[model samples]
Target: MNIVILGAGEVGYHIASRLATEGNDVCVVDQDSERLQVIADAMDVRTVCGKASYPAVLKQAGAAHADLLIAVTTNDEVNMLACQVAHSLFKVPTKLARVREQDYVRHPELFGRDDLPIDKMISPEGEAAKVVMGRLNVSSAQDAREFFNGAIELVEVTVRPKGKLAGLALKELPDVMGELAVYVVAHEHNNRWRVPKGDTVLLAGDSIYVTVEKKHLDRLMKTIDLAYQTPEGRNVMMIGGGRIGYLVAKELEQAGAKVKIIEFNAERAEWLSEHLNNVVVIYGDALDRKLLEEENIDRMDDFLALTNDDENNILGSLIAKRYGVGHVVTLVNKAIYMQLMRQIGLDVTVSPRLSTVATILSHIRKGRIHGMASLADGQLEVLEAEALATSSILDIPLKDLKLPGDTVVGAIMRGNEIIIPNGSVAVKTGDHVLMVTTGESVPEVEKLFAVHLEFF
Candidate 1:
């Protein structure tokens, strides 16, 4: 596919790199020549240096023959205008813009084809908030993503030192946990990731990704030693008044969570106080130890450092953890700090760039894939694809299917029922199949679920 990406920032760079790796003809546009140069030097992609919204820039980026146009400039207006220019002047088939402002996203009617000509709108804040909320909901999960319209869930949890399932082998889990209905899709041990086999044993500090039915989530959590029950009112402290922080506070407050926000900017703090009801907004710096102590950070159920600055967020989250906060969730934009944050005892690290890239890949993947998530910093991928009648693996018991070495069938969603697959389970046509696989195995897994051309 010929693709034009309007932005050379983190999200744009990662998307361009992945698409180019997959053999797509990718061109990136940005006003900053330095950013374009960085992309050009790092990847096999064409880069355009000019204002993204300009018609001449779009044409230079090959928008006229582009199969897809993705506008993700830092400015909301620029992204919107770039999409409009792509659609109006070049007739790009798929126009996706990264819109950040809540005002634009709140109004759905404003984004129609006749109105803005954007086929899809991506919100980094909204996507990050969704990930944060998912983690909070699971409580014990480092990451939680739903698939097949919430019928199935992919949850990542670290094995505790004395946990019940810490040293248990894969084949002994069901017997040990008393008919537990979950699939251990992937395991990360000492920074090495693999699709576990029956003999694989989970060790302490290993992060295990599992697929389970939503209704049986509590059972899985209990088995893994994660907190499954919610207290009367969970106390959440947010250290930012930006878009992601506000959205999280609002969602948590509506769900009966006692929310408090600390913003360094007094104006933004005042705005948050006025806009959000039942949430305490303080005009203070998160890095100030005195302010954190005054706010009783140690007593909070969760501490989230979501400021735009990666250094501040990392420092704030470290201080919170030092003060014995129950859970510390930090937002890190740079991918380099992800492992470092985890090593320093952070509970969860949410990346807007990774979230945005995952959202983009969901739409970009081939076959009948309805959802996609990048896990373990893009090394692993969890995908949900529909099983077609002509699929090669259809109606065959999973044990007999010759799947790729790095792939695991996590769960199957059939209508209202969610099935945690076993050896006896055979995939049927129209079933939404969730698979956990390495990045290299995605295409092979997709082919397994794809309909054959002979059927048509």
Candidate 2:
């Protein structure tokens, strides 16, 4: 597929890199020549240097014959205008724009095809907030992704020293945990990722991804010694009052969590105070130890450092953990900081770029892709695709089905029921199957689910 991306920032760079790696013809356009040079030097993609919204720039980026156009410039107006121009002038088949402004996001009618012509609106802040809220909902998980309309969940838990299942082998989990309906699909040990087998032993500090029914989530967490009960009056402290932080605090407050937000900018703090109910807004910097102490940070149930600056967020989260905060979740934009923060004991780290890329890939992917998530720093992927009648893998027992290396069927969603499949279970047409595999195997997995022309 020919793809044109209208930004060269972190999100756009990652998206371009991934799509190019998958053999797509990707062209990136940015006004900054230096950014375009960086992308050109690092990947096998064409780069255009000019204003992205201009017709000449779009044509230079091959928008006329493009299969898809993705506009993710830092400016909201630029992204919207690029999408409109792509549709109006070039007739790009699919147009996606990254829109962050809440004012514009609240009004859907303003973005219809006749007006803005944006086929999909991607919000980095909103996507990051959803990730943060998912982690909060499953407190024991480092991350959680819902599928099949919340009937199934993929939860990531880091094995801790002295934990109940720290040293247990994968096959012994059922015997030890009383036949719980959970599958250990993938795990990362010593920075190596793998789809675990029966003899694979789970060690302390290993991050394991488990697929389980939504109703059994709590029980599975408890079995792994990572259960967190969200009772009334749960305390959460947010370090930044930006869009992502505000959205998360609002959702948590509505769900009965006592929330407090600290903003460095006085004007934003005042606005938050006026607009938010049941939330304490403090005009203070998160790096100030005195301010954290004054707010009794040690007593908070969770501490989230969500500022735009990666250094500040990392420092603030480390300080919160030092002060004995119950849980510390930090927003780390740079990929380099993710492993460092995890090694140093941050409870959860959310990446806006990763979330945005995953969301965009879900739409870019062929076949009946319902959702897609990148895990373990893009080394692994979990995807949800519908099994069509013409799919090659349909009607075959999972155990006997031949799949690419490092792939596992996590769950099958048929109608209202979620099935944790076994060897005897076979996927049928119209079933939404959740599967896990290495990043390199995604194309092969898509082929198995792709409808064949022979059927028609």
Candidate 3:
């Protein structure tokens, strides 16, 4: 695919590099000559130094022959205008834009007025909110993903010996979870991907990614001794009035959870109070222990440190943990900081860059794959895939079908319900299956489920 990206910022650069890595022709445009040179030198994409809203820049970047044109400039107006010009002049088939403002996203039609040309819009703030909610709903999961229009979910859970599943073997699992097929994609013990043998045993403190069929989700959870049911409304404290805080509070409020927001800027606090009637906004520095205590942070169910300052957010979350908050989540932008923070105390970390990368991969691999996520430091991937009509293993009983041990078929969502299958369970056409596999097992899984005959 020939693609043109407008913007050379973190999001744009990451998207362009990823698409280029997938063998697509990518061209990036930016107004800064220095940034353009950096992108040109590092990535395989072509770079043009000019304003994206200008027709000459679009022509210079080969937007007319582009399959997709992505407008991701920092300015929302620039992105919107670039999309409109590309659509009208270049006739690009797929036009996607990145929007940041809360009001525009809250009511897209207000700005989607007939003039703006765009097929879809991606909001990093909105995506961050979804990621936070996914963790909140599944208390046992370090990460959560929704797929196939919310039909199924993939959750990453740490195996602890205190639970009932502490001493279970691969062969014994089928006896306990007769209806569910369990695959252990990656294990931290040996630090490498290995196909599971029947004698393989699960140990405590091992992180494993699992897939649950939406219909049989309850049974699968019961067998694994995990609390699969959604958590009841819990008190959540947010430390920011920025876009991420607003969206996260909105999601929590909609889920019936009590939400409180703290902002250092009085003007932003007032705006949040006016815009979000459900959230209690307090104008105060979140870094102050006194202010956090005054807001009853000690009694909150969860604390999210989302302030722009990385150090402040990290310190605030640690303070909340010391005060006995059940869960402490912090947003860290730097990849290296994530490892350091996770090691110190924070249970989970959210990255906008990681979310953007996952989204772009999904868009580029949309044919056979529903989506892909890199987990446990790129060692494992929770992949959602669609089976083609003539796929090799179509309509075969899962037990009789041979599959790599490292890959597990988590769940099958046929329509509205989730199915946790067993040996007798047969995979039919049009059923979306979630698989947990390591990098090594991906090829075997794909070959087993190949939709078309191999020509080479």
Candidate 4:
């Protein structure tokens, strides 16, 4: 696919790198020649040094024949303008714009916004807020990825000794839980991803990736001893109330979470207090250890640092971890720092921009997958989709059907039960199926399912 990216920042960089690495014809546009040169040297793609909002600059970046154009600049105005130029001027098939401003996000039609020139809009701050909400609701989970149209959620939890699953072998999991794909994607013991086989055994402290219906999330947590006694405690402490922090705090407070927003600016803090309710606004620098300690940060069940500065969020989250905070989620927009943080053992890293862009790309690549998630650094794509009626899988028992070696059907919901079936299992009409496959086999995997299911 011919793709054009209009930003040189962290979000754009990560998207461009991933897309280019996946063998797409990628071109990047930015005003900074130094950043362009760095990206050019790193990835095999064209780099144009000019303002992306300009038509001539976009033309120079080859937007006319591009299959998709993504504008992810930090500036919301530039992103919108770039999308408009791509869609209205160049007629690019798909246009995506990054909108971080709270006003634009809440009401895109306001302020003379274009009348739907862009195909899609992404808000990294809003995306980060959703992640924070998921973590807060699912107390034991360090991270959560929802799929199957929100019917099921893939949750990441660390195994502890108190649970029935702590020392159990992989083969025994199904007997204990009764039909669930509790795959071990990554293990903290050796700090590497494990390609699961039946014989693999789980140990305490191992990071386990399991899939369960939203209704079953509690039951799954009970197996791991991570379910919260009072799920109603939704109070959240947000440090560095910047774009991400403001969005997250606002969403949480609106959803009945008592949000306490700490901002360095007195004016911003005052503004938030006046505009937001059920919120305890504080004016103080999050980097000041004394101020943070005074706020009783240790008492907060969940702590999130959403400052633009990656170092501040990382350092602050680390400190909060030491204070026995149950969940610590930080937003690191920069890809380089995120890699470093993960290597140093940061449990959960949220990049709204990257996650949003990848989501858009998944839809573009395979029309069948409306929602997709990549586990293990994009090596695997877990997709929720339907099968074609005339496809090879129709009227065939699932267990007897031959599937691609790289792909596995994680779950199929015929009427309920969220059936985790074996090879002899057969899929019926009107059934929703979830499959996990590497990127290369996505197309083939899609062909097996009958086409009666809605493609999104």
Candidate 5:
């Protein structure tokens, strides 16, 4: 596919890298020549330097023959205008724009075909909030993802240092969890992922992805040594009153949490105070130790550092940890900083760019994929895929089916019934199977979603 990406920022860079790696022709447009040069040096994709919203720039980037146009410039107006131009002039089949401003997002009607002509609107703030809420719901989970419309979930848990059940094998977990139905789909140890087998051992610091039914979620959490941060009247202190911050605070307040927000900007703080009824909105720098102490940050159940400044967010989270806060969630934007974050004792972190990238990929991939999410820094993806008629693995027990070592069938959903598959279960047509696989296994798994005329 030939794709044109507007704005060579982090989102654009990530999307470009992803598509270019998959052998798509990706051209990135940006106003910064240096950024374009940096991208050019790193990836095989083409780069053009100009205001991304300009028609001449789009034309220069081969938008006329593009299969998709992705507008992710920092400016909302630029993204909308670029999409409009791509649709009206270039006739691009798919035009997706990243719209951040609340004015544009709250009203979805403005982006219809008769109006802005944007095929899909991606909101990084909303996506990040969803991730944050997922982690917050499971206090000790490194990450959490729901699929099959909340029927199934994939929770990532890390084995604590010197904790119980640290050196146990995959086969031994069932003994620990006597009655609960759960599967360890994939895990990472020492920077390598394995499709866990009966003898696969889980060591301390290893991160395991467990897929379980939503009904047994609490049991699964407890079995894995992770307690649920139940949404019933919990206390939360949020730093940063930006778009992502406001969205999260509103949701948490509605869920019966006592929420407080510390915002640096006076106007935004006032807007938050007016817009959010139950949540307390305070005007002050989130990084200030004095302000945090004054607000009794130490007593809060959860502390979230959500400011745009990476340094401040990290520093604030460290301070919260110092204050003996049980759970601290931080937001970091730079991809380069993601590695260092885990080394610095940060258990959970969300990146808007990564979330937006996953959303964009799901939209582009399109058919038979009910839902998709990226995990373990994009090395792994848990996807809920619809099995097709005449598929190769259909009607065969899972134990006999050949699959890559880096892939595992976590669960299967057939109509109202949810099945935690063992070796005896077989996939049927129209079943939505949730599978966890590494990036290398995508091509192999794609075949299971294909239809064959011979079988039909």
Candidate 6:
């Protein structure tokens, strides 16, 4: 596919990297030569240095023959204008843009095909809030992803030393749980990632990934880890009161949890207090331990370090961890620092920038991909798609199905019934299939599912 990307910032960089990895013909445009050079040297992508909204720049980026145009410049007007120019002059079939300003976000009706021409409007703050809340639902999980409109959830939990699951084999899980449904999709032991077979054994320090029906999520969490507990009217505190923080805090308040938000900027703090009726808005720097102590950090059931600065978020989350907070989630913008966070005991970190990247990719994927998630640092992806009648894998039992060695079917949903698939389970037409696969195996998975029909 010929794709043109506007802006070479964090989101654009990751998008180009992923699309290029998938062997797409991608061209990136940005005003910053240094940023363009950085991505150009790192990935197999064309880079154009100029004003992205200019028709000449779009033409230079191959927008005339491009399959899609993505505008993610920092300025919302520039992004919108780039899309309009791409549509008016280049006739690009698909246009996606990032619009984050509250004024623009509050009025989504401002975008339309006739006027704005933006096929999809990406909101990093909104996606980040959803990611944060999903993690909170599975507090003991390393991370969690929802699919099929939240009918199924995928969670990863590290096997703690001496935990009940540390010594069990993969095949024993179903028997141990009696009639409850659960499926072990993959495991990450040491640095190796693979689909776990029946003989695969669980060991301490190994990351185990599983999928279960949403109704049985809590039961599965507790069964996998003896120490797992549900959050009950808990105190949830956030260190940043920015847009992302406000969205998360508002959801937390509506969930009936005690919520508090601390903002470094006095004006924003005042605004948050006036807007959020239930949340306690504090005006203080999160880096000050004295302020956190005065707020009774130890009593917080969940501590969110949502500041924009990666260093401060990391340090603040570490402090919350040291205080024995039940769950410590930090907002890390840079992908480089996120891997370090999990290794240093902060298991969950949200990247709004990368979250927006996933949103864009999901919009670009050719199959009827309901949703997609990157796991194991983008090496692996969980994709949910509908099974077509002509799909090669249908009617054949999974045991005899020829799937990529790096792929595993996590769950299947037929109407309202959720199936934790096994070797004998066969997929039916129109069933929503949730599968996890490596980056290289994605194309093969799509081919096998007969989801080759075009989708924007």
lDDT of 5 by residue, 349-453 (tens): 999889999998777776677677888778887778889896776998998988865788999999989998999999999999998887656656767888211
What lDDT score is found at residue 364 in candidate 1? 68
Candidate 1 Cα outliers beyond 4 Å, as residue runs: 230-232, 451-456
User: On residues 120-236, what C-alpha lDDT tens digit does candidate 2 reach at each position?
Assistant: 899999999999988888876888889888999899888889887789998888887787888889988877888988899999899898899999888887776676565247788
Model 3 segments more than 4 A misplaced: 32-42, 110-114, 148-151, 161-183, 186-203, 214-231, 367-381, 392-408, 414-426, 436-456
RMSD score of candidate 3 (Å): 4.4
Quote the positional error of residue 369 for candidate 5 in Å: 0.8
What is the overall TM-score of model 3 with all chains considered together? 0.83
Candidate 5 off by > 4 Å: 451-456
Error of 5 at 98 (Å): 0.5
Looking at model 1, residue 261 earns an lDDT score of 94
lDDT of 2 at 365: 73
Among all windows of ten consecutive residues in candidate 5, which has the lowest summed lDDT? 447-456
Clashing pairs in 3: 179-421, 211-410, 213-411, 214-418, 215-417, 215-418, 215-419, 216-418
Stretches of model 4 off by over 4 angstroms after superposition? 110-116, 161-163, 178-189, 229-231, 340-345, 363-366, 376-379, 392-406, 415-417, 428-430, 439-456
Q: For residues 1-456, could you state the per-residue lDDT of candidate 1 as single tens digits?
A: 799999999999999988887678999999899999999999999999999999999999999998899998999999999888888999887888899999999997998778998878999999999988887887668888888888777888888898887898999988756876888898888777788999999888888888888878888887666776442398889899899999988898889889889999999999998999999999988888899899999899888888999999999988888888877788999988987766788858899999999998787665588778999888888888898888887988999989987988899988888889999999998988888887777777878987221100
Model 1 sits at a Cα RMSD from the real structure of 2.4
Q: After superposition, how far is residue 348 of candidate 4 from its true place, in Å?
A: 3.1
